[model samples]
Target: MRYSASHKLETREKLLQSSAVSAKRSGFSTVGVDGLMKAIGLSGGAFYSHFSSKDELFASVVESELRQSLERLGAEQDRDKLERCLKQYLSMCHVEHPETGCALPALGAEIARSDIAIRQQAEHWICQLQESWAQVLESDSLAWAILSQCIGALVVARMLATTELQHKVLKSSYDEIGRQIAGPGA
Candidate 1:
């Protein structure tokens, strides 16, 4: 019995989707092939048919996750996009829900230590993300600053033990970013 090419593509997409969730929810480095296969109801033996290696999956996951982050952060949305996107991203809801959130806060450092190929792929998406933000925010400097701050704030908020502190980090960063982007005296 052989699967059609479209079926194979569908299965591969399923695996990528599940892997993206697992990578964002847990560390990408922490999820094994068996676990990822189990997630899509496929046997571990079927894993190789989709991805050549875990490193390959890591790169794909990074690409998929960053694409999502770009969309969620209002990649090509209108002028009010930044503020609206930040309101969602810097909320406690996002902090508590890692599965549906941006991958950067959860796995940026981990991916930074990945193989050169994966790191290069990540750098491409990172620049793409910056470009997306730059489109709406106008200045490359402002785009980089906001993206760095958002990633840092979420990472710190996720690390802390208390919800209060987490919300504080989120709110403070949110307000500060809004002010900075709003320009002087804003």
Candidate 2:
């Protein structure tokens, strides 16, 4: 049965969204076209009708994930609210739920090893994130530091052996960084 163009587009989008969640929970390379299509209730053969190749689908998925992350962070230009946002971002919930969390912390390594198109998309997203953060920071250095710390902390927390260790890593990193940013004066 032939589907309308709009229906085809919608199905393709659904597949991309599903693939993004799966990629985040597992790894991008591990998400097969067949599994992605099945998750979206479509036949695997239709995958190529939507995407030219797995790489194309991957690039689209990365773009979608990055957009979602930016929206999740809300207004990044307010310094007073940024720390609270960061704390929430690096919390245990974020660590335990990769599918619903930031793609950077969940799939940074995979993105780094991806094709040029994917890497370019990731780089653009990182720059945009950094710029948003910089607007809320006292200096560029602080913005860079905060961004790096948040990503690093989340990655490390996700890699720990136990939930206790993950919580400890997140708490320590959050508290120390928060204190440093707040300073003794404020």
Candidate 3:
């Protein structure tokens, strides 16, 4: 029996959400199309109905995840409490839950080498994220630096084997970011 359009759309959304978590937990390059479809309670063949290839699925996942993260980051923004928002970005919760956290630290390196289309998509979202921060801080340079540091700190922290080291990495970056956000002038 043929599924209705609404059913197909719902199924596609389910696949995209599950795919995002899978890709975030395991790098996009390592997430197989078959396994992803299976994890979402669909046959491996069903994946082809929604996405042409793993690359296509990956692009969708990246776009979905990045958009979700951007909205979250924007919600955290309080012009008078910028550090609080930045703090959320660097929190231990985000560090421990890569599956639902920002895509930059989890997939940035992989996207850097992906096709031009994927890179452009990532760059667009990154710019949006930066623009949100810039609007709150009123300094494009600081916004870029703070966003860069947050991504870098999370990447380094996740790479380390020791929890102590991870905390240290996050702490150092957080302290410095806070300091920079609230300069002597503030």
Candidate 4:
């Protein structure tokens, strides 16, 4: 059966989206190509039609997830809008829902361990996100700091066993970032 180009593209999109959610929810390496394909109602053999290898699929997932994160978290130019984004990002809802939230907190460890090519792809989107904040804040260091804080806070929050501690982790980070953004005098 020969599928049209658009149909192939749609299948690929479904595969990517399903793979990303699975990866974020349960480390990318844990799931095989068969599992990824199974999630999208296709056989494992069809995987090759969309990607050359599992690594290639992973790279695509990384790019897709991070680009989406960039659009959600980095599109703001004003301080108020950025702060609002941060608040939502640092909430318990985000911590409780790794499958649908930003990829950084969910997949940072895997991304750090991936090949140089994957790391570079992650860096491209991450740097673009930082630049958006940098332009708004007028300080590259601050942008980087806040970015790290947000991801780290989420990671730590999710690690804790109790929701109380998780909320503390998130609230503290949110407070500190707000203070930093307000500057020394404020």
Candidate 5:
């Protein structure tokens, strides 16, 4: 049966969203089209109707995840409350839920090894994040530095050996960076 264009688009979006979460949880390269399609209640063959190939779907998924992260950050735009938002982002909760967490820490390594289309999308997202952060921070360089530190800290924390170690990494990184951001000199 032929589905309407709108239905097809919606199904494609569902697939992309589901794939994004799965990819974040299980690394993009390791996820199969069949599994992603199954999660969205669609057949693997239908994937081609929405995307030319897995890479195309991957690119879309990257964009969707990036937009989600930006939206979350955007909600905390008020400069006075930026640190609170950052604290939440660098917390243990964020580290423990990669599937629903920030795309950078979840799939940064995989994205780095992906093709040009995926890499470009990732780069675009990073630029947007840097710009948004720059607007809130006193200095662009400081914003970039803070952004890097936060992402790096999250990635490292997520990679730790134990839950206690993960929490320690996150707490120490958060405290040190938070102090730096709050210091009179900053």
Candidate 6:
């Protein structure tokens, strides 16, 4: 019994979505192909039907996650909207919910450790996101600075043991970014 093309596509989508969430919540390198397949209600053997290897699936996951991030954060055409987006990104909710939030802070280290091809794929999406912001902010450097700060803030906040410290990290980053955006020609 052969599956139809649509069935194959749907199954692939499900696998990608489940694997991405798992990777963000846990870590991509830590989870094996069997586990990823299990998350999508399939056996390990079914994974190769969608992707050649775990590395391929990871590349796909990184691309999918970063593309979604670009869609969410890159669409803001004005400073106010961008600030709101950043605020949400740096919130405690995002810190506590890695599976549902941006993949950067969650998987940055893993991406860095990945092979060159995956790193290049991540770089492409990240650059697209920065370019979108640069258009709105009219400064490439400022866009890069804010992007780095937001991701770093989330990573740092998540590492802290107490909610108070987490909040302090988030609020400080947001407040400083606000000042930077308000200064000079910004």
Worst 10 residues of 5 by lDDT: 73-82
Residue 66's C-alpha lDDT in candidate 5?
Answer: 89
How accurate locally is residue 40 in candidate 5, as Cα lDDT from 0 to 100? Answer: 89
- lDDT of every model, 2 decimals: 0.87, 0.83, 0.85, 0.95, 0.83, 0.93
lDDT (10s digit) by residue, model 4, range 124-178: 9999999999999899999999999999999999999999999999999999999
Pick the winner on TM-score between candidates 4 and 6. Answer: 4
Question: For model 3, how does the per-residue alpha-carbon lDDT over 8-82 read when each residue is reduced to its tens digit?
Answer: 899999999887887778887786778888888988988888888988888888898889878878545776566
Over 4 Å off in model 2, which ranges? 74-76, 183-186
lDDT of 6 by residue, 125-148 (tens): 999999989998889999999999
lDDT of 2 by residue, 1-186 (tens): 888999988888899889988999999888788999999998899899999998898888889888777776644458667877878887999998989889888788888888888899888877777777777665677767878888899999888879999998899888877876786776
| lDDT for 113 (candidate 4) | 94
lDDT of 6 at 26: 92
Badly placed stretches (over 4 Å) of model 5 are 184-186
Candidate 2 lDDT score at position 99: 91
Q: What's the CA RMSD for each of the models?
A: 1.4, 1.6, 1.6, 0.8, 1.7, 1.3
Local error of candidate 2 at residue 78 (angstroms): 1.1
TM-scores for the candidates: 0.94, 0.92, 0.94, 0.98, 0.92, 0.97
Q: CA shift at 172, candidate 6, in angstroms?
A: 0.2
- Number of clashes in model 4? 0
Top candidate when judged by TM-score against the true structure: 4
Better of 5 and 6 by TM-score: 6
Model 2 local distance difference test score: 0.83
User: Model 1: per-residue lDDT, tens digit, 1-186?
Assistant: 999999999999999999988887888778789999999998999999988998888888888888777667746666586788888989998899888899888888888898888888878888988888888878899989999999899999999999999999999999999888888876
